[model samples]
Target: MTISTEMLWLIIGCAIVTWLPRILPFIFVRALTLPDVVLRWLGYIPVCILSALVFESLLDTSGPIVSFHWSKVLTFVPTLAVALLTKSLSLTVITGVVVMALVRFML
Candidate 1:
């Protein structure tokens, strides 16, 4: 469907509002002194968010299963172990997604 001019303007305005908060940090990061604790937490936020998302997607469902899905457990348990051992978020997520997809396709 074609968007109306008013709707287009609203979307543009919303985009600007959404972007300013994210942009403001980079714009001001150079001019400020940051607390070490706050900076460390900020560094961790993305990994925490990613793990939360992966956990929910892997483990949360509307109904119960007879036994835990072994393949999902197989995929994610190793993913977490590797992530912790190596301290690599990207590798962990990629392995989890790939292994789960492979197991799903195989069975």
Candidate 2:
């Protein structure tokens, strides 16, 4: 396959468009001092987003009634325990993945 100049420029443009929004905020915020309340609230954003994602995956809401995904719930038990016990993100993720793999393998 041959690459066209127009397609190359398009790719470069797309890269800049995708990168600007992510990089611009940090560049602009570097010099500014955010208020303590704002900083505290920002810290909760990651936890809230993570919780939302985890809970969404754990429950099945496609039908009329919401139901729990037993396999995920089973995986979650050890994962949550590891997270609380170690307070290590890397270890918690490893535990979750390994536990889920085992659950899938067993069932």
Candidate 3:
């Protein structure tokens, strides 16, 4: 298949649009030195986001009452343990994946 002129420009435009936001922050922030308090506060952002995502997936709120997904809760126990004990992001992710696979297999 041949690429059309319009399609090529469209692709380039999309690439610029997608790349600018991700790159602009670093470029702008590189020159400025953030204070210790702001840096410390920024550190908690990832943890807060991850916790929100995990908790959202672990509970079912479709009905009037909230309910726990037992399989996810079971998987979370070991994953949380691994995260706390190892303090390794990779190990925690691996533990969560393996435990989730096992839970799905057994159930």
Candidate 4:
């Protein structure tokens, strides 16, 4: 229940380590002007990251071979529909979570 002095120091050290990487980018880029192409390319980062995460999560790889989860696939249906129709991240995430929870509870 009580944190020792050493543990406190460890926590402070971890905080500084985590904070530096996040803050350094802003400090270094504040005055810099990136090119238009670079800026345009950076716009796709979110979509690419999301696609990678979604595909990885949908296909499970706990064993030697990659396997697809029907629960996730089924949940993705309504989630994708909502995302495409509304184009809202919040709604899509909520729909996915609700569908997955229902699928898990029912099956």
Candidate 2 lDDT, tens digit per residue, 1-107?
99999999999999999999989989988999999999999999998998999999999998899999999999999999998999999999999999999999999
lDDT of 3 by residue, 1-107 (tens): 89999999999999999999989989988999999999999999998998999999999888899999989999999999998999999999999999999999999
- Per-residue alpha-carbon lDDT of candidate 1 for residues 7-101, written as tens digits (9 for 90 to 100): 99999999999999989999998999999999999999998998888666666465685444567777878788888988997988888888889
User: What are the RMSD figures for all models against the true structure?
Assistant: 5.2, 3.9, 4.4, 2.7
Cα misplacement distance, residue 80 of candidate 3 (Å): 1.0
Error of 4 at 25 (Å): 1.8
- Which 10 consecutive positions of candidate 3 have the poorest summed lDDT? 60-69
- Which residue ranges in model 1 land beyond 4 Å of their true spot? 56-107
**What TM-score would each prediction reach against the true structure?**
0.49, 0.62, 0.58, 0.72
List of clashing residue pairs for candidate 2: none
In candidate 3, which residue pairs clash? none
Each candidate structure's count of clashing pairs: 0, 0, 0, 0
Evaluated at residue 91, the lDDT of candidate 4 is 92
The lDDT of model 3 is 0.95
